[model samples]
Target chain A: MNTKTRDTLGKVGVFALASVPLLDGIWRVTSGTRLGGNPIETLEHLSGQWALYLLAITLALTPLRTLFGWRWQLKLRRMLGLFAAFYALVHVVCYVWLDLGFAWDEIGTELIGRPTITIGAVAALGLLVLALTSPRAAVRRLGKRWQPLHRSVYLIAVMAVVHVAWKGKDGGEDALVYALVLIALLLPRFAVLAKKRSSPQA
Target chain B: MMRKAISSNEITPESVFLKRRQVLQAAMALGAGSLVGCSVDSAEADTPSAATTRALTSTGSTDFAGGENWTPEKLVTSYNNFYELGLDKGDPAKNADWLKTDGWTVEVGGACAKPGTFAVEDLVNFNALEERVYRLRCVEAWSMVVPWLGVPLGDMLKRFEPTSNAKYVRFDTVLDPDNLKGQRSSILQWPYTEGLRIDEAMHPLSFMAVGLYGKTLPAQNGAPLRLVMPWKYGYKSIKSIVKIEFVEEQPDTSWNLSAPHEYGFYSNVNPSVSHPRWSQARERRIDGNVLSAKIDTQMFNGYADEVASLYTGMDLSKSF
Candidate 1:
């Protein structure tokens, strides 16, 4: 396939995968099968989980490309990151609008008082910064600084995992699964970094 | 006037009724019913097992009818938080069959005049069961209204004639790991324990729930026996009880032990005191219809008039 056709297919694939959750969420609401008993909670959990999944996937893209020489993976990173941001936005909005009824005063207190929410707010802010700068123009504008700016995603991923771990009422089993996935995705980068530091040319 | 208003059902019972209004408000506020109440099947009736589903006397009136939003028996039975059966909300309904409640005996002792192992059936049969509709608000910010058939906890406790040394009443759930699946995981200190102050334990609202929905208790809903503290959060209502003890010192509770910062012993429904992880200011009614906006949580979960005096002069926010 030509470069343009491959790019088009790639964009289509990203949209398809990302929209699946949104559509399924919508269908669940309309069809009454997936919302469970707590609809807002169901939506909040679904969107938040999807956000974490997409964020992890986006973080994995770099290591996957370096390990397997999958250059096409580079093209998909921005889309996945933006989708993660979108879901994160939905998750936050649900908490603010649905759960809190836009109680700004209480929300302000919660943002500072509750560690779980504070961590969530910071991670969300990081995702927002990354998402806003994801466009090609912003990347060009930020130039060399863009790499470090986007690198904050690893920190954001950790914050998200911590938020889940601390907030889990029953046990941290589900949160631990995400933590394991994040560790697995990050291990390859440490190996590569170690190789660079040990080079004789240095 | 407030009591009369509540009796008149103006205040609305539990979160579900509030949720229905919230859904309506959301439909209007968001300009769409499409977003909330997404599942029609949520209202589908779960057929009771032929063996367990028997017709019983509906002896009690809906005295606590806060609104017309009584939670269905199926949802109440199926969606439970009994960790013994499992952590998942639906696990109890599926796995509780393994719990053999038949021929169960409750060991009652400590600080009381009468102290001995009593047959569960004898205790349940001793009391004249009355149906009382009470709102159950879970600490996870969910609420349900259940018409429970049971005797007053005070009536049963009074029989033992707790001595002045008795400062607290402690209850214990079934401990066998072979039957209760979650017991093996140590998610909580197994053989779950909960306690209440002597005053709180004997309050008129404190009930020893034997059954729900005009029938025998489903194994999932703390079948055979359970403590129902309507004013407090649901976890305080220990289920599948095997032991009841009167103690001088404050008894160690399972949830409070599990996460002292998060779950306090005085887990009264206080919206102001947010849980460490989530806000208790509002709750999503599990029985609410689609589009139900989250309802503001009430102080003492709308039973303030009845139980608020019990905490007089005590700092709830700190004790919480």
Candidate 2:
């Protein structure tokens, strides 16, 4: 296949893969198949898991580009990051709308009083900022500031892990796996930074 | 309101019970019916077994006067936190069929005069079973109202003859790693254990449930026998109990051993004391609706009237 056709197909594939959970969630709501007894919790868990999975995949892209010199992978990073943000937004909406039934007073209390909720809200906010500034125009305007701002994804990822671990009932095995993945992705970048700093030329 | 004793004739046939559940579910979907006036039936339609399908006789006992609707039987059976089966709420119902509850035995020892092994059938039929609708508040900030049929725990403990040194009661789950999939993973210490002060154990409200919704308890809902302390967090009420030890000192509890800062021996449902991770102020009720608003968690899960005097001099926040 030609480069143009392959690229178009690749983008379509990414979009379709990312859209699966959301579409499944909709189908579950409509048809009530595999929604389990507690539909709200099912959807809440579904969206939150997809968001974390996408965020982890998005973070992994950078390390893959650095290690394999695959420049084409960078083209998908923004779209993947934005999809993560979209799911994160859906997760919060499920919490506020379906879980809490839009009780504004309870929502305020949960945001402020619950540690896990607070940490999750902050991570969602960080993702929101990253999503808003992901456009080409904003990238040019921010220039030097963009890299540092986007680097906050590391902090957001840590918060997400903490949020999940804290909320889990049985010891946080899921969170541990995510933590290990994040560490693996971050280790190569830190090694390169260390090498650059320790060089005699510097 | 006086409740009539459930007669053997009133027992729902398996087919009719399953059909009624489906109709109730449809009515709920149409938003035309609340869970009020719904009768008990076998919950496990997927796993049809003679043991789980058996019906039990239950006379209604004291329940919350607040008129909170019973959480649908499907949710009560499906949504569980039996770590022995799995971590997720739905895991228990799916995986608990592997558990062998027939001819189960519980060993009564440690500071008891008549320390002996008793079969589950003898233990459950030892005293008349009474159905008590209770508010089960989990530390995870979720709640459910369940109709549990069993005798008071104190009634059965008295038969074991707890000695003077029996200051506390420790309950342990069956430790079968080969059968219980969650036991293979070290997420929690094997054979989950829980304890209660002697007084707490003997409290009139502390129930030993053998059945729910007028049917024999499903394996997922802690079949054979389980404790139901309405005033404490749901974890305080251990499931699939195989051992009951009466000890002098406060025995080690699974949650407290796992996270001391978050879970204490006396995990009474107190809204004032927040868990290190989450707020205890409000809890999402597992009613049929996915969009139900969360309700304010009550002090002692609304059993304060009967159980508050038990903790009269102690600080609940510290103990929590």
Candidate 3:
């Protein structure tokens, strides 16, 4: 009904959804099953799925609010965005720890050698900036500048989708479905932004 | 078509079999997936009809006198990469317990005068393994030498008499997304589905294998049951099968539907035909020790003479 009510629901949904992947990660580890299909490919894919889910969930909040005109939807944006960041962080941890074996040199090699890994790293870097700016103090300090910094999530979303599309050994229906959902969630916002930019301010 | 057994320079002398211990120590140089287990150790023990896994360096001979001389380490790890069981080469070995084969049955419905489901044990005996060393290849461009033991699929199919109209045969694997976490991800379809032309299903070389390396099938490796089509890519042979539906029209396969640009239903092994993204010409062999120099892959996993007639006129590259 109201923005606050929508925000509460959105917050619950995001947190609960976030916990599923976390629980899955923990269960897999505890069960002694490595992530993904094969051993060599597991941790990275698990991390990637988390990162992809976070970005998608973050992108989804606004359209969800608009579609139903729920005011509370606005309140949960921060939580969803943070969850995206959380998954992205786990993705990074998996890549750094299990995949690269915490070898900085190997990390650098993956970042340089693979275009998907490179784009993913850049997206993570952008999210890092946004995460730091997410705090009230930085938002208050940057004022007008903070808004632009956060908008980078849009780029992060696009890059994240492309990274999976390009790097996936398969076409990755998992990646494709996430991309489609993210697009459905974000397209209306894009049209609104385009309209505002094009129309002359009265 | 039943293949004529031709005596080639292929079968080695009896003396080499007797002195295998001295010649195989240096063999560890091969890579993983080099062989899928039919070794002197796990695949076949020191029984009267068994072969020993001598280290390649233990003896100066780089070659074996009989069918390909593969080690146990190579045999256990080298053969069969069925994704329907799980995604990884090892996933089949790790998480295949959820697959129920005890009450498993195949649907003999398509063209049979009296179509019905037949229990697995009633259909074929699992105790005996028909050992034939063959080349195993993957669509991903890897190969291994395997001494396979099993019966012909056609032999089993013949038990169910067809009245006609059976153009295609489909195999369905057990689908519990909880156990098959990879299926839960929607990479391919949740329950994997694959098919073959009725003739292909009835080919002599197509064997439904229940075990490798002389023991019962391991849980991780499609366990209770799996198929072995030496002439086709690993995927063509379905694993952990629960249902075998015989149909009139062609069936939709999981990989072909998921990515049509890749994965054709006719996934025959041909070195000349390359996949859109990768080469099928060379293979990385996994013999469990050396991890390198496994050797180049041959056409049809070297079973072409027996199966070439299956695809006489069709362009393999385009079909692939």
Candidate 4:
């Protein structure tokens, strides 16, 4: 396809891929199929899982571009990050409003008392910062600092995994799967860091 | 004369009963589809054992207005929290089909006058089976009101005549890996054990449940026998009890041992005592109304009137 056609197709592909989870959630709610017995918990889990999945996808873009020379994958990173942040926002809202019954007192108690909640809150806050500054104007204004500030995705990814694992009723079997994915995504970054440290650039 | 009563109640012939069970089993298996996970050998015709005891009628009181607007039986049965079967709510209903409870015995020992293993039937036959409606509050902030058919645990335990030294009562659940899949995993130390204070054990509200809604307890719902401490969290009420021991000191419990910080020894339904991970102030009623708001959890799950005095001197927040 031509440059204009490729751009249009790429945007279309991103939109369709991103909307799949949200649409599936809506369909489940409407059809009364896969939401399980507890709809609130089902919705919460679905949104949270999608958020993690999108975040992982966002992180994978850099590695994919470097390894395969697929420069086009970089264009979709912004959309994936925003979607991850959006779903994460949904996750937090669902916990506070649907699960907690908008009990601000209880939410406050959870934020302070529970490590899982505290870690999740911190991750959500980081995502919020990235999402807010994702616009072209904000990125341009931030200049060189934008790249460093946005790298907090690494920290957010770790916190997300820890939050789920720590709050698991049984052992962290479900969390372990996500943790493995995040580790794989971070491996390339670690290798690059190691190389930079080894080379005598000075 | 007793034979006539038994024969009259169990009118269907053994062949017919087996056929009906097969039909029901097939229907359940089909309805559940892939969710059941484990397969029961379709070729083998499993019998409900010769020792399958009937639920005897009792003159016990059914005057409980506490559990109003009862949760539907479907929700209650389908959504179980039996960790023995699996972690998922539906896992028990799906996976517990292979569980054979007919040939079961419970060993009651330690500080009791009668310290011997007894048939499960004999234990049920000995007690007057009463129907009691109780609200079960789970530590996960979910609640269910179930009409359980059984006897007062106090009445049943007292028959054995506990020694004065028996300060606590420890109950152990069945640990067969063939039925209890979770038993294979060391998820909270195998052979799940729960305990109650001697006084708590003898409380009028505490029950030894064998059935729900006029039917014998389903395999998933702790068939044969299970302890029902309605005022406390559901975990306190251990399922498929295999052993009961009366000891001088406080007995070690499963959940408390699993995570001391999360699950306390006295897992009473207290709204004030927040679980390290979640708040206990409110609970979602699992009655198919997921969209509706959560109800404020009552102190002692609305059994404070009956069980509150039991914990009067103790600081529940610290003990929890």
Best by the TM-score measure: 2
Fraction of the true interface contacts (Cα pairs closer than 8 Å across chains) found in each model: 0.38, 0.52, 0.05, 0.29
lDDT of 2 by residue, A26-66 (tens): 85577554566567877888899989999999998888877
Q: Compare candidates 1 and 2 on TM-score and give the better one.
A: 2
Candidate 4 segments whose C-alpha is farther than 4 A from its true place: A1-11, A32-34, A65-72, B1-67
Number of the top lDDT candidate: 2
- Please give the lDDT score at residue B238 for candidate 3: 76
Instruction: State the C-alpha lDDT per candidate.
Output: 0.80, 0.82, 0.63, 0.80
lDDT of 2: 0.82
TM-score for candidate 4 (chain B):
0.82
What number of backbone clashes does candidate 1 have, counting pairs of residues 3 or more apart or in separate chains?
A: 9
As for TM-score, the candidate ahead, 1 or 4, is: 1
The DockQ values of the predictions, listed in order, are: 0.44, 0.35, 0.05, 0.23
Which candidate tops DockQ? 1
If the candidates were sorted by their lDDT against the true structure, best first, what order would they fall in?
2, 1, 4, 3
- Expressed as tens digits, the lDDT of each residue in B1-320 for candidate 1 is 01122432235542445456446644443432354423223223242453654445544455564864667665787677888887766677767676888788999999988888888666765336788888889999899888888888998888888999999999999888887778887678988999999999989999998788767787888878899998789999999899999999999999999889888898999998878777898777776345677777889999999999999999998899
Interface RMSD of each: 4.4, 6.8, 10.2, 7.4
State the TM-score of the second chain for every model. 0.84, 0.86, 0.73, 0.82
Model 2 residue pairs with clashes: none
